[model samples]
Every structure is written in C-alpha cells, then in structure tokens.
Target: MADSTNQSTVVAFIHTYRPDGRLDSYMSELVDAFVRCGIRLHLVITNHIVPNLDSTALKKHISEQRLIEYINDVDPEFIFTTNRGGITKGIMEKTHAPILTWMVDHTPFFHHGGGPEDLFCEKDHCIISSLRHVKVFESTYPVLKGRVHYLPFATKVEDFKTSRNVVQDVDISFVGTYFHSGILENLYNYYADSPETIQGLLRLAGKIQSDPDTDILPLIEAYGIRKVLEDFNYNHIYLKWLFVNYISLNQRIKVLDAVSDLGLRLYGTDNWLHVGAYSLNLLGCFQFQKKIDTRQKLVELYQRSRIGLNISHHQAGGGLPYRIFDLLASNALLVTNARKDSDLFHLFGEDVQVPMYKNEQDLRKIVIYYLENEKERRELVQYCNRLVDRGFSFEDRVRSFFEIAGCRLKETGHGQLVKVDPDSFIRGLVRYLYRCGGNKPYSSQEKAAPAGGDRIKKIYHRYATGKQRLFIARQVVPLIPNGIIDMLRKQ
Candidate 1:
C-alpha cells in the first residue's frame, strides 16, 4: 500500500438496475471529487444492476467476484453504496472494508413515503443528508444512529461545462414513471376520473360561485398518511398498497400513456416496455438505460433541448434528484412540477429557474417559450450553468462531502462525521418519488435550516431503545464471515 495521504477509495454499490439514476451521478461526482483530492474511486455495480455489462464496450468493467474479491484486492478504506436490498447488504457482511452506504433509496420504504429501512441504512455507517431519512432510520431500525452522518450529495458544475449542443432530440422531454398511494391515488383519480384537473376546478370555482374549501381534501395526520410513520414499517405498508391496487394499475398506466404521447424519449422499468409496443406515439421504452452511456449522450443532447421537464405525481416525499444538477450543469432549462416541494428550484432557480407545470398547460408554456425565444433559452442555460458551477455542482458538493464524512483531508488528516442539509436530503427522497428530482434549495432558509423532522423524538428513541445494548449486539451479531472470524482469531 502506498501509505499516501489520499489512499482511500470509494465504491458505490447499486443492487438493482440503476442504469438511469442519481446514485451513478453521485458516483460520478465522487470519482471526480476524490480523484481531484488524489483519492481513487472504483464504482462497484452489482451484476443484477448491470446484467448487460457483458457487452464488448462494457466488458472491461465486468468482474465475476466483483465486490468480494475487489474488497480483498483493493482493501479500500471506504465503500459507498445506496440501497441495502441484496448485493449491498451482502457486501456489508462479507468485506473487511469500512463500508459507507450513501443512503440513496432503500427500496420498499421509499416506494412508500417512510420506514425503518432509512434508520437501518444509517446504522450501517452510510452518511445520510436528510433529517427525515435519519429519523426514519433511527426510529425504525434498532442499530443505525451515530453511524449515519449528514453528508449531502456531491453536486458538480463540470457536467454542464460542455458545449455538446447538438440538434434537439425532442422539443419537450421528461424521463419518469410512477405509482400512487391511497392518498395520491385518490387525488389523481379525482382528477383523472373527472373531465378536468383540480387546477381546472379551482379556475372554474373562481368563475362560478362556489367555496374552494369544499373541494380541498382534508390533511391526513402525519403519523398515519401513506408516508413513513414513527410506529409503522413503511415498507410493509407500501408493499400492501402495491398488492391491493393491483387492479387500479390500469388507470395509472392510462395516465402514463397520455404523458408519453407528448414528445419525450421516455423509458422506465420493464412493466412500461409493454406500453411502447402498443402505442404508436411511443418511440421506444427499455427496462433500464445505461447512465454512463446516456450521460455521455446527454452532455451533448441537452444543449439543443428546449424544455427538460420533470413531473412527479407525489409532492411531499421525493426531493430534487442528482440529474437536476446534471441538467443544470449541462445547461438544460428544467421545467418541473416540483412547486410544493424543494429540489430543482432550490439553488439554481435564483439564476435560471424553469417554470413549474401544474398540468399540460404549464408544460406547454415552457416548451413553447424555450422553443421560440432561442436567445432566452440559451441565457437560461448559461444562468443555470453558473449556479451549478458556483457551489451546486456535484464535484464541489462532494468535496463538501469529503469534509462532512470526516475523510481526513490531506491537510486535516482526520476521520470525522459530517453535517449535510435538508434540501439535499429531500432530493435524496425524491428519487423514491417515481422520477422526482433532487436538491431544489432555491432559497437560503432550506440550505440553513436543519432538515425538517421531529428531532426530540429521535433523541428520546435512541436511549429508550437501549442503543448501548444494540451496539453491543451489533458487534457480536454473527455478521463477519466464519473464515474472516477465524483469520482474526488466529491473529
């Protein structure tokens, strides 16, 4: 081993097929951030995630023993991963490498609004940025508390530094697909089942004599909504929802079909592959599109693009995505329906903000404006690029990550915990929001405020749950491989 100051290596684990996701971008930014600091990074993707990595182009990245052997071979000081489903959890127990799980989205729970999985992820030493995520992890999983740090996503500006302005592929494009919970489903169905949207109803109410309050759905108690409640296993709640609404799937698909008809090179998980085969407007749909391949393409494609759209069905949970920064970095004008939430418009909205689309009308306005006012569109791109460059860029953000994670900067040379913010944290949740973007800290308050959540409860829960006993149990939890345990015994 070189014993150099920058000897640490980061490995990002993707258990599922995240061919198109923010984790990869986080990985990309981590690489640039670390390498610039002289630390090497190896992106450890699961075979499950990259089933087609066997292609000649991607063959060099293929490794049979991937994580297991790589940990042995590289003996990296740090391993950064997002989900803990299969491969990531498998790697955690199997390796001696001090693991760092970048808690991106721990499936089932994220599919629902909240759960103990977040807490479980935190206990495993994954630096978490959001307080909501930290609370979920802390309250649910007995083991993960201090292990999680407030390390925000590594947003970089370099991604948009390119001039890959090729001809526009689609006039207005958004890549997303989602399902709804009882709350969201009811809200959406109310709109879909009707001849008009809630926005339309509100407008009609203004013209006609009717009380607007009557139309409003009463707010559900925080603890009981489909989101992660303090007492419930949010993942289970969501899984149950998925099964019950199995038939309502048709109505959901119908909405997605309508969205697809408008020009966007859309693709999602395998279920949507059928939609492409059936619809004439549907040009193509694949199970997963490669991020590295797509990024290389998007660096050029976004330049010519007018309105890059993001519409999410659910508003509360999903935060700004890493891709939003990528688009801003690529200087693509982002049009989104993220008004109620904070993600895309958080930082860059001050400079080059994209308008929020309430329905197809807002979407149409953005598409046309960016199309007609070419000079204005270019200015917006430049403005967004400036925001991304200033501090919102992934590289700079992850460099902040390096400081927060307490990865001994060559100067400081000390390993410590980090303090990341809520907006970045919310963006972390948005990925779970079926194509929600991340990190929309348009104002200073979000950046400055501690991520919104019940802090006192989290503190009380820690001691009440006997964290000391749990920590002791975790130490003897029979996690290390027998061979490794024997090796240690012999030593």
Candidate 2:
C-alpha cells in the first residue's frame, strides 16, 4: 500500500500470473468493506505467470509497473497481498502499509509432499512458528505476529441470498479435484476397510454415482456429450493417459479413476495442469475460457447456480473456501465437506448451519432430497443469507483484524530462554524427506470416494502432473531405489 494524499486506505492484491484471475469472489466485497471504513483500497499485482514469463503480455489485463504506479498514485493507508511467491510478498513487505498475507489453500506444502527427495520450503507449506494457533504478530517477521491472524479466506453471501431455486442438473457433481485412475480401486479399499457399511451404502452410492438407467451417471455421455466431445482440443493435453500415470506415481491416481466412473460432468481449469488430473483422465469436462477478465461474469454465476460445489482434497486442512461465502451470498446453496466444522460454517454463518455431506455415499443419498425438497432448500438459503449479513462479511474480518492486531501490540511478555535449538534443519530435512517421500502414509482414495458413482463420471487418464513424479514411482515400487540408496548412505 502506498502513502496516499487521498484519505482512503488502499488495498493491494498479488496473483501468480495475470491480475484478473487472482480476484476470486471475496475481493471486491473486501475492498468495499475497507472503503466503508474510510480506507481507499488500491490493488498492486505482478502480471507474470512463470518467473521468466513474468512480463507484460502475461499481464494483458494490467501492467505490473502500472499497477504499482496506480497504487502509488492514490497512495492509500493499508496494503495486503496474496502470496504469488516469496519474492512477491517480499516486495510488498517493503512498502509502508502493513502487509497482510493470506494462504488460499494448504498450498505451501502441496505438489512436493509424498516424495523421497525434499524440495524447497517455499514449494511446500511454511509454518513460521506455530504461535500455538493463536493470532500473534510478533516473531522474526514479528510484525506479522502483530499484523497477521490466521484469517481464513473470504466468502460472499450473494449466491445463498439471490439464486432462484433451480434443479441441480447432475445427481452427484464432485467439482474440486479428483484422481481418475486408481479411483475404483481406492473406492473398494475404503469399503474393504469398513466392510460392514458396504451392503448398506452400496445401493445409495450406486444411485448417486449414477441415477439408475437414463445415462452412464452418464450426464455427460447423455446431456453434455458435446462438452466432453470438445476434449480433443489442445486444452485437454493434461487429462491424457500418460500424465495420469505420471502424477499418480507419487500422488493420487486411484482416487481420480474412481471419481471417473461416477459419470457426471467433472469440471476443472486454472493452473489445472500444475498438479492433479487437470489434463489426465479429466478428459471431457475440461472447459477453458480463453483467458477473459471475468469478475462480473463469476459474480453472475453464483446467481445462476442451483448448488455451488466446494470440496477439498483430504490433505487440504478441511475444505473451507472463499467461494463458500460467495456462493451463499449469491443465494446459492453450498454443498461442501466441513473444514473446521466448528469455526468454518459458524464463522461464516450465524443462525443457519450450512449443510455438510460426510462421504460420497452420504452426499449422494441427500442430493435428491435437497433437490426434491425445494421448500427446505429455499428456507436454508434464506436463513444462511441472513446469518452472513450479520456475522461473516469481509468487513467483519477486517474489523476483527484491528482488534486482534491491537491486542498483540499491547501485550508485555518475557521472551523464553532457549532450552535447546528448535529441531535442527539437518534432522528436520532428513525426516521430512523420509516422511514426505513415503514414511508418512498416503491417504487412500477409494476410502476417499463415496460408495458408488456407477454413473461413470470421467475415467481421467493417469496424469503426469509434471511436477516431480514422486507419487507415481512410489506406487510402482514402495521406494524409489536410487533415492532410497542416497538416503541410507546419508543415514
């Protein structure tokens, strides 16, 4: 944030690539809320995607320096940044405005986990010092202990408030990411792990994965076949067979496959190719909009949606999302797995508790009822809309920030004497390499899937996930021989 001759506070945001995609539904409301508080929000962004291509065309919507100049030109009071990389945040930290950082996903530790060799920390989740989960801003970037709070992402109330009740087109639509290859096997494993539930849930899972008769869970093979038919386009290279086989080695292949057969239109895009089955077997459902400035369009989507979907990968620390509030705010019903059950829903809602589905079986069984039960759906949406109106807007979050930041600054505390060095980097490195490599057990996908999507979604081909193929090699051999040899010699 820059010093503004103008009195309003300026808010700045950073993105991985171009400026437009970075602003999910939560941003505008956040800025509006800050402006309500008398601070003018100004945004600064890096127009680059890859570090090298971090140039002008990549930022066609807005230029990098121009963005900075705009912020400097207005010169506001507060500055906040969405981390694109260490470098992006580092620059913002240099500015006069207090820089607040938000982690959208358990992203810091993504892609690189579950591999034998360790990569850089920035490539994975970085825990500066667990302030005991307390909101403290006083450590090395001690200012963060003061400026930062474990502020989860933002949510808008539009979808839940204004969307007209419409029928959900597909029976079971698993929107986030899914593993396509071993998905079937993983599903079996989950049931096998709990054979008792197999008989009871099997029928429901089958119905959910596929609606019995009409199509293949075949919503795509039937209604949306044209959407899938377009898969031959250059956009779908990631959903191919070889790529699935590649990433599945170190990551989740079986899970993707199982989600495939459920037969609904699986949706994905974004840096979808960076990880998971974006390209792999996630074939037909891939919809790429040739990069457009789509903020207004997305806000409109929440209004049109009957049910907005948000699911987190198992390792993703609970599946809460900014869009959850956005969907609800738009008056759309949200069908999501619980993140931190107590905090997530309640934090976002006041009187109405948002509905949560436990497993694929649990979710499918209830979908029909929610659809058929329109009165109940309308009631839920209305109740949730009112709840956020009172408790969970970005305005609420920013006000909460001042209170938390203020409390910490006033605290007087004695610094602890070091009884010992924090875990040594060398030992910590060895342990993470071992555990991330394979020591830490991979969570099973079949167990990950709901009972049965006989609907036959997409059998996303085994995708390479082009990152390091650690997840793949692990499946082939419990250990990567070369990497294992290196570890033992070090030991």
Candidate 3:
C-alpha cells in the first residue's frame, strides 16, 4: 500500500448495472463532483456509461485479464464503485489503490452467501445508505470496522435545477414500479394452501416494515417459520429481500390508493394499472404516464409538479430516499410516509417537521393542506432547499469519500466538507424529537430475539425428524463410490 499523500488525485469510477440505467445519472453526478474537487476521473464503464448488460455480455466485452491490465495502467489513487461492479480480488491484488463501494440498496444482499470479503481488501471501504446497515455490516464483517460509513443518497443540485418560471401543472408525481409478480409473489403462492403459513409471511412482512434494520433470521425464527424456510432452501438474506419486496408492494398499494384521488401522475411501468388497489385507484384522478427514459424528463416532471410524492423502498431502512433530495432540488414540496428512524429530523430540524404521514387519512389530509396553502408549501420547500445547499450534496459526499480513504485533494474550488459533530447532533436531534413527541432514533444493535412458541416447537420437531433421514444418508452415501451412487439414483 503506497502512502495516500504521495498518490496522485486520480480515480477509476466503476459504473455498475441497473436494468433501467437510472444509476448512470448518479455516476455522472459523482464524476462531476470529483472533477470539481480537482480529481481526474477514469470512467470505467461499458458503451453507454450504463453497464446494464448481463454477466455474460459483460464478460464478452470486459475480460478479467483486460480489467487487471486497465487498472495497472491507470494506477489510480483509488477505485470507486456504486455497487461491487466487476472488480474482484484478482484486480485488487494487481493495484495499490483501495476500493470504495457505495451500497445503494439493502446491505444484506451484498454480504449474503458470498460476502464483501470477496471484493473488499483490508483497507478498502464501503458506504451504506442506512445507518442500520452500517452497524450491522460492521458487526457481521468485523474486518471492516472503521471502514464502514453512513452516507444516504444525495443529489447534484445542478442536475436537478429547473426554471422556476415553469408552471406547476402536475398536482402530484410518483416514480416507481409495481411489484405485481416476482419471488415474493411466488413464495406467497407456494404457501396459499396453508393459511397459517401465509399469515406468518404477512406477519413477518409487517414486522420488517416496522423495524427494517433488524436481521431477518431472528424475525423468521420468532414468527415460527424458520423450519418452513429451511424446507424451501431459502437463506436469511434471500428471505430478507423477499420480505422487503412484500412490504414495499403492499405499502405502495395502500399509499397510492389513499392519494390516488389527488390526481397523482404516476410515471412507472404498465404493471401499476393491474396491481391490487392500484387497479381501482387508477379509475379516479390517476394518470398512467409512460416510464421516464431520461434524467432531464424526470427532473422536469418534478419541477412542474406541486407535490412530489415519495414512498421509501423498505430496503432503505432509516435512510431518506434519493427522491427526497431530487424533488427538493427541483423546487417541489415533498410529501412522504414517515421514515422508521429520526433521520428526517436529523437533517431538517425537528420544528420544520417535513411533511410526512402515518396513515391513509393522514396522507390525504397533509397532501390537501399543502395543496391548498401554496405560500406555506413554498416556504417549507425553500427552507429544505437551503438546507441541501448548505450541505448534503454529492459534492460534499465526494469530498467525504476521499477524506475517508485518507486521500487529500490537490486543489480546492467550490467543494467543501460539511463539518458535523455526530454525538452532539444526534443528542440534540433525539432530544428535540422526543420533546415534540415524534419518532425517535432506533439503534440496529437492539436485540430482536426469536420467540419460542408452541408452533415453533412443532416446527422444530418436524424439522428434526426430516433431518434424521438426511443425517443417516450423509454418513452412508459418502462411503459408496461415485459410480454406485449414480447407478442407485438411476434405479
């Protein structure tokens, strides 16, 4: 490892894949931020700057050998990735530069069966969107203790800038997909015959929404479904993904149904037209606009909409959605569901009380209140925009990333790091929110112990009985030759 002080301010930014290629906008924002900080960027991406190709396609274009050679040639000060990208230990071993991965989604998926150890070196660091993820990642992968940092999604104000003169024609806007059918749906259907099992799944989903940062295994065990999941060969991380998806689908349906009467202009896939409550919601005040193709179009929509609505993906845990910043940047007042933790109050003061709702009636009331009072709404938007300007931009994030990597910028321009006293800030934020009788901060370290109910005991016995047969086969099968085992299976 060479001294970061002696290293040149060059970075190889790895642009990973998103099916919709929405993340390319984020990559561009980071590149612009890095350039402003006097750091040269080598955009390591496929043809369109959005590496949306599958693994086979990616391998056909970029071979491991070529990637290694490219890294050796660039010899960048450090490497940055939004997700893991194609960077592997083989590539990491060939360069002195460290790796920095910003986990934009659920952290467990990254550390599932094959964890971050496969990609990150000892000095390599990662940034997670949720603080709950940060604590869990550190506790799970102890090697990367101080290497983990919490940085929620941020926007490049310049990218989202729009003309204030544009009329706010759209009353409300929502940009997301409808999870009509997927793994979560498949799991639900598989247990359709067992109402108790379905109830257990729904119960797990509800619990996850309430406390998303907690690991899912304990929750499953607590709900008396560990044996059922084991029967299907589903691991904890995979279950976590399924449960989060379930919560997201159900919650989106509920919220959209409540606000659908408010003339919501939804910009997403066609799936929204057929989903549960959305099918009925579409009949009243909902316009099914085509999915957005470009970043400019999405920003324009936000700028033209009086209220930009957000439903945080359950995967984000306590982190504010990236939409929050983008909508505010485009001068749209945001109305969102209440987040799990006090991150909302932590960023914007406890007094301003960023427009958030607890239930369907509450959502309708808040949206209508803001819509009727344009003066108050605009004032709130301006305050949040000022807060974003003071800090919380991608430029600040880029600087923080380098500072965490122990690299100093060669030249400073408009870029500045936001100085924050974590202890003081959290203390004040929590105290004020508590006084206001609002949602307080939740620590991921809090234990969520598994329940030992009679149902769970029955499941355990059944699981043990089923395992006894496999236990006997394992001892005897290995002693036989491979040819005999294959012949027996054929018979």
Candidate 4:
C-alpha cells in the first residue's frame, strides 16, 4: 500500500528519442493526468533509446550517475519509469521509494538477453499492458510474485475526434514499423545453416499465423526443436527471438498478400521491402510520414478507411496493440487476427463491437463483408466509440493508478467519490456519468494553484459537454509544440 500522507511527488525516468529521431508520445497523457491530480513531476531523461523505450518522454542524458543524483535531489515518494533497462541494481540501491515499472511491450522483447535473475528487482512493482504477459512473467520469473498487474492501453478520447474531411481513399490500412535489419539478418543466417530446424520453424510459424491462439511452446516441444536448440547451446533467448521474428513477419506478409486484391495502403517504415523479392511491389503501396505527424496521420487513416487492421505480434499472447485503442477511438471499424486468451472478446462482445478473425482467409472474408455492408460497419464503429468514451480514457487510467497505489483522495464539500472498473459495464456507465456531468474529480484548487491553470479547467468543461478541445493533450507536449521549451529555458 502507498503512504497516503506523502503521495505528492514522483520522479520519472524516461527516454526522449529513438535512433530515427522520432518523438515518443507515450508520456504526454499520463503526465497531463498527473498534473491534473495535483502531483508534482520530476523528469530524468536518458539518451539511449531503443524500441522498448520508444514511447518515453523527451529529455537527454547518457549517464546513470546523473540520474541517481537527480532522484536523490528530488527525494520523491515514488519513482516511475517504463523501460526495463532503465532500472538497475545501482539505481535500486540509491532510492528507497517504490519503483513502479509500466511495461508497454511484450516480455520476451525486453527480457531476451538476460536471465530471470537479472530482469527483476525486489523493490519493483510491475504494471503490464497484457494479462498474458503477467502470466508469462509470473511463471517464468520467481521474483515477480505478487508484484505484477495488468492494465491495457487506453486513448485520450478527448484528443481523438472524428475528422470533418472524411475521405475513404483506401479500403483498408496498416500503420506500424518493420523489424530491425540486424534481427532479420540473424534470422536469415540461422535459416541457412539449419534446414530441418528451419522447416520445423516454418511449420510452427504457419500454425501460429493460421491461428494466433495456438499454444506454440507445446508445438515446439512436440517438434523436438526445443531439445535440438538446447543441444546446440542456443538457449531460450535465441529461440524466443527466432520464434517471434519468423512468426510475426510471416503473418504480416501473409495478411498483406491475402488483402492485396483489395484497395490497401501501408503506412510505416520501409523495411517491408526486405521481406521477399515480391515485397518490392508490396512496398510500392507503402506510405511514409514525418516523424512528428505519425499520430495525427494514424487518426486520419482510421477516419478515412472502411476497415482498419491490427496485427499483434505472436509474443503478445492475447495482448492488444496500441492500434486497437486508436482505431476504436477514431470510430473506425476494426478487423484483427484473434489472439490466444485475449480479453477483447470479453470486453467487446464477440462479433458485436469488433470482428476477430481466425486466419488470413477469415480476415479477408470479414473485411469484404464489412466493406460490402456499410450500415453494419457504421453501427459497430458507433458501438466501439461509446465503449471507449465510457471507460478507456487516460483520466480513467490515472484513477486506476491511484487505486493500485492505494492513495485515497481527500473528500471535500464540493467533491463526489465515484468508483470505476474497466472490466465491468455498470461501473463504466457510472464513471461516464460522473465524468460527463457530476462533480469534477482530481481538482486540487483547495491544495494549491491547479496544474495547467484555468486552461485545463475550461478544457475539462468542454470535455464534459462533448466538445473537442482546440488541441489534443496526447501530442508531444500537450498543446505546446516541441523545441519551444528549449527556447524558453535558454532565455
């Protein structure tokens, strides 16, 4: 449980850049919500950015020693970060505050090189994006017992609005980046060296692609691939990398090939060209974008397309990608491959809110059905939008954080306490009414001057009335453009 008496300050360590110089939009919504909740934020920015840390905040430092010094200076009650690499023994020893790690990606991707012993610390409390991942960690690492929690990705519903200029230029669309070259090269080398192993892997990949819900580990053991790999000293990490890459890339390519006859637009990095010789033609249909405008472009794509596709990596194990929230938030019809043990069907009823497919054939059939039947698609979009509006906003997520931290808000004369549960429909309805018309939660006027000032208050009122704010809060700096802060600081 959190120390309710001293829940005022928190220090966050995050990365601000990727190798490609693209800005990560992950922390904007959380930071905005924290400020609104009357918590002061102290940011520690690290410079070494990787895919796992892509969604971190913008600040640049390469030294861990400087980070320790800064955290000690702040003396915050809680420490927060998203990156697994950012947490180390040295940093853990330096701070007494509980370290909260909110993992946004799959466990295998971050825990590949290190053993379970090196991956977790005693002071860590983990909040994962998928329930499947929580199971994976608890079963794989003994140290993670009783410290893991699951919280899915949510949208800033107030920030994502239906665009006026709705043009269905593309019948279907996919927005994501391809894998790194080094990973692909490693896969290619392994495939060339081991023919039988490669054949078994290809079959396994097919099984997963045909049905993502398939339990792959049992299949690996049955094929004797696990034993063979162990004999060759390949280790579990190498096997994980091979399995994820082969399964994910093959499935993506197969989906694209199945949907090629339809009007499809691919928006992401150019690594799709290396998938195969015929991939050049596929790459021809690719669309690129300025790094800063990626989020805006995705919303536009969702609004303009009749169908949006979300492909979760095989390692996701029934966890949803960020794209699912974005598509629903934009009020677009989504067709995604089904995952094993996914909570999506439970959250949104089977074939009622959004359609899930078993294989590429199923995906194509569903996409065509929705495209031919415009009325059904529109209704489904409206249904999903209402669902998101009710309980999946960033504000709701912040409230969940408060619950997880055991921090109780002080009651005052004007404030009303409301309970919200993301999984329950009734609680979601109650939360929606409370947010839309009831007394404003998270108001700190009695404590200190409110964060974001009157601007945020006015925006909150507009949100309640179903009016779009002039600027979305999930942008890199929430209404302020990038580089402006640097200029102001220099002055």
Worst 10 residues of 4 by lDDT: 417-426
lDDT of each: 0.44, 0.39, 0.62, 0.59
Quick one: best lDDT, which candidate?
Answer: 3
RMSD to the native, candidate 1?
Answer: 16.8
- Residues 321-371, candidate 2, lDDT per residue (tens digit)? 555656566545767664343345435554446777665565554555676
User: TM-scores for all candidates?
Assistant: 0.54, 0.48, 0.71, 0.69
lDDT of 3 by residue, 1-491 (tens): 32234324554544433454334555666666777776656565432321242221222112344455555666666777655554555555676777787776653233112443453568679888776678787875677888899886788676545466688988888877675447777877887898878888888877777876666667777777786667776556557766777778778878877778787877666666666344566545434555564567777888889898888887775677778888767778988788557467666666655788888889999999999999999898887677677577777887788787887766644432221111121222122222223223222233432332222322322332243423433342334444543432221
Can you rank all candidates by lDDT, best first?
A: 3, 4, 1, 2
**Which has the greatest TM-score?**
3
lDDT of 4 by residue, 1-491 (tens): 23233346666655443455433554555666666665666554433322244222111212234445556666665677764645555567777777777766553223223454556667777787777677666666567788888888887676566473577767888876565536535654766777877677667767756654455668787765785555545545445555575667766877877787787787666666565565655666666443324456657667878888988776676778778887887756878887547768656656544688898899889988998999998888877777677777665766666566555533222221121111121112112222333233333224432344434444433342232322332221243433542332221
Give candidate 1 misplaced runs (Cα > 4 Å).
Answer: 1-6, 16-33, 48-76, 85-98, 106-123, 127-134, 142-156, 176-263, 267-271, 276-292, 313-318, 345-352, 411-491
The regions of model 2 sitting more than 4 angstroms off are 1-6, 11-13, 16-25, 28-38, 48-76, 84-97, 107-147, 158-266, 270-296, 313-316, 339-342, 345-352, 398-491
When sorted by TM-score, best at the front, the candidate numbers are: 3, 4, 1, 2
Q: Could you tell which candidate, 1 or 4, scores higher by TM-score?
A: 4
Worst 10 residues of 2 by lDDT: 453-462
